[model samples]
Target: MLALPTLSSNGITLKPLTLSNATDLAEACQDGELWKINETSVPEPDKVMDYINTAASMPDRQAFVVIDDLTGKAIGSTSFHDILPFVKRLEIGYTWYAKSYWRTHVNTTCKLMLLTYIFETLEYQTVGWRTNIGNHRSQQAIERLGAKKDGVIRGNRVCRNGVISDTVMYSLIKSEWLPVKLELTKKLNDAH
Candidate 1:
């Protein structure tokens, strides 16, 4: 069992998913339009509590509501799922943000914090991402993070709206993390 660390970076913090987060998560899920770039569609507020509870119960899945300590509000959500500890790999997905945080440093900072943990702390060899092929913004974002394009898996995934779609695979191996992390940090700092 991997113990999750209390992670914080640049005023952004990640708290483990819990029943206490239901309302804030439900409210964040109200930004349904953000699903355009998010492969998983946001659930209705009425369903968020159950959805979050279910996530909290999953042994291999851990979700976090991205919070900004400045205003003490949840700005978005991200998760580490598809954990394969024996193989030392985990897929980072199910990420989205409120409109106010988009195009800001929040996303990168969140990724930086999470990747730092996954690669450095956990000593995990690989971190992977799968994005809907049609989601160009997500594809670009993953690329900008310096993940290597491993090629597309045609018709590899299904969307929330019940549409079958291809997935573009990207990954960062442990050996490649240093340069990428340096580049990502520079980009994030330049933006600040």
Candidate 2:
């Protein structure tokens, strides 16, 4: 199992998600009742512990709670799952933030931090992302990060609502990281 490290930058922090974070995460989900969104993996307040446990139990996943440093509150969650150390690759998924944080610099900063750690620190070759086909906003966000759409998998998995959904795939190889990193840094700077 890979050890997850705490990452912080630009007033945001990504800490390893744990059972102790359950209360904060539950409150974060309540911001927009995120659990109601079928396409997302956000859990209901009552299920927060189960969610954290499941995430922690995954041998191939490293989950993090997105925290707003200014307030020391959990704002959302994201993970590096589907790890393939042999191939030096992983997919970033199971990400969601409070509605108020949307359209802000939070996502960009988080992506920059994760990308830097994966590509530079960890020396990973490629990073991938997968989202529900119906999640247009997520698709746009992933694209905005410079990930190229690879394709979609039909009936990839059943969603929380029991609907079988297509999964949209995207990836960014190491060769593409420099430009993407520059762009992400620019976006963060411009947001200030």
Q: For this target, which candidate reaches the highest lDDT against the unseen true structure? A: 2
Off by over 4 Å in 1: 35-38
Cα RMSD, model 1: 1.8
Question: lDDT per residue, candidate 1, 1-192, as tens digits?
Answer: 567677898889987766777677677766655544436645566787777777778888888889988988776778898899988999888787776677788889999999999998999999999888888888898998989999989987878777789999999999999998998899888987
Sequence-dependent TM-score of model 2: 0.98
Off by over 4 Å in 2: none
Return the TM-score for candidate 1, rounded to 2 decimals.
0.91
lDDT of candidate 2?
0.94
If scored against the real structure, what TM-score would every candidate get? 0.91, 0.98
**Which 10 consecutive residues of model 1 have the lowest summed lDDT?**
32-41
Native-structure RMSD, model 2? 0.6
Candidate 2's residue-wise lDDT over 44-92, tens digit each?
9999999999998988998999999999999999999999999999999
